[model samples]
Target: MVQDVTLVDGAGSGPAAARIPPAPLGRNRDFLLLWSGASMSFLANRVTTVAYPLIVLWHTGSPLAMSVVSTAALLPLLLVQLPAGALVDRWDRRRLMLVCELGRVAAVGSVALALAAGRVTVAHLAAVAFTEASLAVFYRLAERGAVRNIVHPAHLSTALSRNEARGRAAGLLGQPGGVLLQSAGRWVPFGFGVLGYLVSAVSLLLIRKDFQQERDPTAGRGRMAGEIAEGMRWLWRQRFLRAAFAYVAGTNVLFQMLALALILRVKEAGLPSATLAIVLGIGGVGGLCGALVGGWVQRRARQRTLLIAGAVAWAVLIGAMGFTREPVLLGALYAGTGFVGAVFNVAAAVYQVRTTPDALQGRVAAAAGLVGSGTNALGSFAGGLLLAAWGALPTVRAIAIAMAVLALLAAVAPDLKGELPDDGTDTDAVG
Candidate 1:
């Protein structure tokens, strides 16, 4: 029931083109509700992400603890994701999302209680946060995978944009909240996170349609791991998608390396948490603009070229983060990097949504998610260690050089420069 759409120019002289059938629910109804709920969930999740680190720092003052939580949160993608994706395809996506939200609600609420009671241990909190994050990744996969079922394909660009917009909005809210909450009580944001999850679950319950297709009585699925491989196989056959996945996974290493370095450098420079918040907020604005512009750019440019440019920009901006200690300069760099990165993300999202087959999207997305996270995990771990070893400036410089080399190569991928096939061959390959 994905909404179908037409992308005619606003000017009448451009000519009218009929799009496919509209989304199952009109723009302002069920879809908006879903959108609002989803956006809030993102905001809440980010709040927890920021709050957790500060809480750990407050309790243990240990960089090692931050590393531990960061590792626990991300490594699940490498280890547990194949089965998670397979499970998503097997379950009712809507119900699964609802249940997943409730699980987060309980987990965060428990953490809040434990923190309030001074009963929280770094180990116990890590377990809660990690489990909650793993579930969150699953719900995100289900949401993206189910979008095609909830709305028509023609409208996919719009739906995806809306989702990105929500995330940006959440980023705006959460970035500041995350920093500010540390000043209040480390436990406060977790309470908000619990509320957000509960509200998101309520929103899921209010959705009106059957988003999942009823399974055929005769069709039997194999093991989750087998299904995961099936998804990966489909991805590999698409030369474009394979390249895209590799590019995304590759760039993430640089992205998080820079981010981790920024935190270390900024904290060392005695910058206020508010300053960091501003940097993140401005970056969120850049992301907002990118999301708005990405669709049009897609219509006009080659995906690989734009994607490569974005990667290069990510590298350069992040390198600049280390070279300058001025808060204003850093904020500007963060904003620019965020804007370009958002363009990259929106473009990639479009490619994935259009190319992947609906039935297999969950698994494909999950596998893709794993690829992205696993790469980021390495970078994050490396970033932490690199900071401990050589200080932030050198690590940032190294990431910059690495990303520049990768972007240079990506721009020349032969398949990226040509016209797409008539039957959406390129789309499927990249998806």
Candidate 2:
């Protein structure tokens, strides 16, 4: 069972008493446990993400080997999302999360042990990376569904904002932490992953709340394909969500192109590689700050407002990038975009969680994730081609033009006109 107690702002009567405020998320024990566990898991994932290529390059001295392992890690995002979402909906989410953490520990631990024995092969590394990533997919889907179950309805937005900030902080710290640990030993980063998963597992054990609503025993017995299709159909029927997904997909592709273009611009200008790092660090800080303020933004603005404004902001910032190659200026522009992205993410996540039924949370989230991120690889490939063909300046200017078009479409889209109610009730009505 989940506890969703409402906390009043102050002792009062009549309407004042009815105006129940949410308890601070910091005071929620179950949510704290969940957050801590997830924080560790996210940090661990980032640490290994940086270490994987480094380990392969150091041990095998083969960029091809590094690419193979990295590709293996990413394959789960493409292949596992749909099916994993289905399983997450059908399975006991808490138990599933426990299994996932244990599986990750074993997979990453195997790599550490192999490295210790001086017997790690590229194939083994690839297999471990794939397995670890696959488990992470399941864990992430389960966690997404579990969030709404653990907090009061009034606190959901704030909870999600904190989660977003945690992820940004992890990204900010994890890569450098990975590199520092690897300097201590090739196996040290993987050992850190093992420890992180163990901590996550322990936290899961301490949580007293259920991660989801009780399911009707007869439901979810359909074939996996059928379940997946049902989820897809539900998402397709939401006019606002459909429009939002399209916007996200387009912006994601454009961002990918911009990232690659930024690197090329720096290289072409004969800047030191550290300049790129400083720019990215600035962007990460900006994202963290945006996430920290996301709750405030969400409470004050409508979903449509955030979406349209974010698209417009991104367009302006990216357009500005086309006019400058200075490291500090590029960093500032990139950071602005990052801020907008984080705020948008928080708003979108709250809308999705508040509207979708608990039974469909995992499937809907997975489906939405696939639609949003499925084109990332295509975007990266296109970015490479565009950079090769037109050089960095022209490619960025072209992307800016495309983004402005996206912003225009967002402003005029009919489905994006009104605000969706966020009363935390599950409904099938189209937004």
Residue 395, candidate 1: Cα error in Å is: 5.1
lDDT score, residue 74, model 2? Answer: 93
Candidate 2 residue spans exceeding 4 A from truth? 1-21, 424-431
RMSD (CA, Å), each prediction: 5.4, 4.0
Using alpha carbons, what is the TM-score of model 2? 0.94
Could you give candidate 2's per-residue lDDT for residues 1-431 as a string of tens digits? 12122221222222354356756778889999999999999999999889999999999899999999999999999999999999999999999999999999999999999989999999999999999989998998899888877877667789899999999999999999999999999999999999999999999999988888766989988999999998888777676787888889999999889999999999999999999998999999999999999988999998888887888888788888888889998999999999999999999998887777778888989998897779898789999999999999999888988888988898899877644565432233524
lDDT of 1 by residue, 165-268 (tens): 67777777786788788588867899999989888888888877555544564443886668788878887767777877787888888778878887877788
The lDDT of model 1 is 0.74
- Please count the clashing residue pairs in each candidate, in the order shown: 13, 0
What count of clashes does model 1 give?
A: 13
- Which TM-score value belongs to model 1? 0.82
